[model samples]
Target chain A: MKLLLLSNSAAPGRSYLDHAREVIAEHLDGVTELLFVPYALADHDGYTAKVAAFMDTLGIRVRGAHTAREPRELVASAQAVFIGGGNSFRLLKSLQRHGLVDAVARRIRADGVPYMGSSAGTNMACPTLRTTNDMPIVQPVSFDTLGLVPFQINPHYLDPVPGSAHMGETREERLRQLLEENDVPVLGLREGTWLRRSHDALELGGLAAGARLFTSGAEPVEHAPGADLSPLLAAEARFDCRPD
Target chain B: MKLLLLSNSAAPGRSYLDHAREVIAEHLDGVTELLFVPYALADHDGYTAKVAAFMDTLGIRVRGAHTAREPRELVASAQAVFIGGGNSFRLLKSLQRHGLVDAVARRIRADGVPYMGSSAGTNMACPTLRTTNDMPIVQPVSFDTLGLVPFQINPHYLDPVPGSAHMGETREERLRQLLEENDVPVLGLREGTWLRRSHDALELGGLAAGARLFTSGAEPVEHAPGADLSPLLAAEARFDCRPD
Candidate 1:
């Protein structure tokens, strides 16, 4: 199974076009069951509609794409689940009430369904949804989600805050505290960059910008992010994001 | 299954203690399996010790507790799990790499084990961790987590940001976006406050500092948030917390 995680909704990296293309490729080009979760998609109304248009453009078959109506049924026939980005919290909670979580999990475990997510969708792959750095107004029961991917992903990685005296714990400090207490690798994906997991490892994808990989076992590494993705043409094959 | 989620490590909620006591007295007490996951126990070396002491004082036997060590076996054995808070990201990744992901799922599913998470721990109980206002420096591979609770938990609830050009997203905005995206409720769990889910409904806990509950299907309602936790107490259950 292959899963794609994007940090945001706007254009892959900069504003949204590339992200759109990535979704098409992940869902239409080489998969069977397609599931798109747009928690953050709410911020931009055009998100789901635009994706609907894109599905038509690519001629990809979508068994389930929304959480508002007939929610759990959508995941029943899906071979690929695509979760678009917007707000991670809202997206997840929507998935919960509609009772589609089990459907997604079953698809992943029993069917080896191909999974694709961007922004908020990508965030859902981690152990907890707290790493998304999105606002916290909405509350779902848990930050836990589909464990298709292994690393906690930061889609839009920005530089450290400028100046001193902000006093509040800086984002880096918070993450550092996380690292100090835990034993997993942290990946900082810049705009236009993505992470792909299949088989047995995690690999960086997307060429729009550079990506940084951080792990408890070693120092941080930076890379250009992705390949042509032509290597993943086969639909049934599995991909792992870990380094070889 | 009886679960207890705490806010911060600083103090155990009076209401939380009360409810736990009551649950133990009615059906758990001696038969309960007590497991403490200090997955976020970093920064202060005293954190873990403090937790240990608290358990000792409560007269609860620490069947097992984990600091840096993976607790797969312990998680598997426990009838209930209490995850403490430190950093949301840290706690999350620990849960992920330790293979606690599947273990937690099993406990919740087959065993119907009670799951309690606080602060960082509380953040992990949601569907997605995006509800937290914590900074994103440390990144975990995926946003997957234990789905014991079904609401976005915003620990340390506070008033609006007075005024600032912080550049980075504000805490309120983070919470707002989380709520806007999905249909689940957001629990604005101020320090000393908590939400409890029993059978099929949710109960607000903590009087010293009351918590607020937000749902996409309904407007946000404040659970009692105050200093006096006596009203929220359950009775006769032993518990513990430590600062490492």
Candidate 2:
């Protein structure tokens, strides 16, 4: 399967998708048209239009899956798929309601279609949406997602601020609590980072600030931009509890 | 009904329960013993013991609900109930699993048992756990919480950092997104602040940092300490979607 899972769409000073323009272009190389899933945000047309405008600069035509009469069929016929980020719960609920979870997964894993995701969309590629930082504004049918990748992903991961007086659990603490219930590895992707999976090799790429890998009985290990994370694809996911 | 919901158990540089010692003592006036629910954290025994140590200083005997032969009976017989803070999802899951949701609610509303919650515990007093700031580390049977209060509560509410490049949604943004899905109002309780309800009166009280009240379409309004929030107790909760 081919995937480009980004941590975020924008960086500090750059416009949407501007920071990783080159990487996105290379990931969608030779592809003339791409299908965009814009269900994460409330405004589907607006989100699709924003992405289309950006993809236009890269010499590609963007079609919104929401506009398709048959979204599943659109996924099946697409040369590449891109899912933008917003609220993960809303995204998963829409995907489950539209019956596109299996359809998109089949397209990516069985048909080898290139898949790209940002923020909540990046969360969609994981086994479950359990690690997302978004609030549960709405409930999905389940925490289960595409499962295109073996482990979980915590998108937009933030390290604890030094000397902050806030008592809320830091990003690391929450992920550690997750490990107490589920024996699955979590990849905390900081902003400006993207994980590219080309066939069997998975490479972390972006500007400086890298990523952190968290496992069940160990301290989180940090990785740089060029780190090889292909081994995590073989990790087994065993959940001890379910939402229902 | 009498309730004391704290945004956090400890403020900056303060020991557990120390920041709210005077208020807690007043809230638990004439009461000698309190039943503590520690299911939010994995180590129930440790959590219960920690709360017990703090409550001892307030001249109250603390009992762990986990240690009771029948937890429901313990809730029924308690002079006051205190649910310590940890993970909201885990806390709700355990409460639902042990059949304590209804029991605790009955004690608070029907029996007038004083209910005290900190952080995740504070979230339990709301209609649902949708507004909590914690990660979905575990899935509860449902997002349904105690519903001791009419609206939702977002504990540990943090303002957006000035000029920070993080692309993740701010606390205000996430709460606004929640308004899109549910018609219920939300109370964003910042640290060093709390909500206290007695009989038919509700008041925002605690340290200097105040609270933010969020409605469906209106911009959030700020409330100072000692602000009259009794009207919110009558607000209706209408959930547009359910997890199942």
Best by TM-score: 2
TM-score of the second chain in candidate 1: 0.73
| lDDT digits (tens) for residues B1-244 of candidate 2 | 9999999997778889899999999999999999999988889889888998988898899899899767998988899999989888888988987899999999999999899999999999998888888888887878888999899988888888988666778899898888877899899888889999998899999877799999987988999999999999889888754232
How accurate locally is residue A158 in candidate 1, as Cα lDDT from 0 to 100?
63
Q: Considering just chain B, what TM-score does every model have?
A: 0.73, 0.97
Best of the candidates, lDDT: 2
CAPRI quality of model 2: medium
- Please give the range of 10 consecutive residues that has the lowest summed lDDT in model 1 chain B: B235-244
lDDT over C-alpha atoms for residue B207 of model 1: 46
Task: Please give the distance, in angstroms, between residue B123's alpha carbon in candidate 2 and its true position after superposition.
Answer: 0.7
Fraction of true contacts kept, per model?
Answer: 0.37, 0.75
Please give, for residues A110-148, the per-residue lDDT of candidate 2 as tens digits: 999999999999999999888999898887878899998
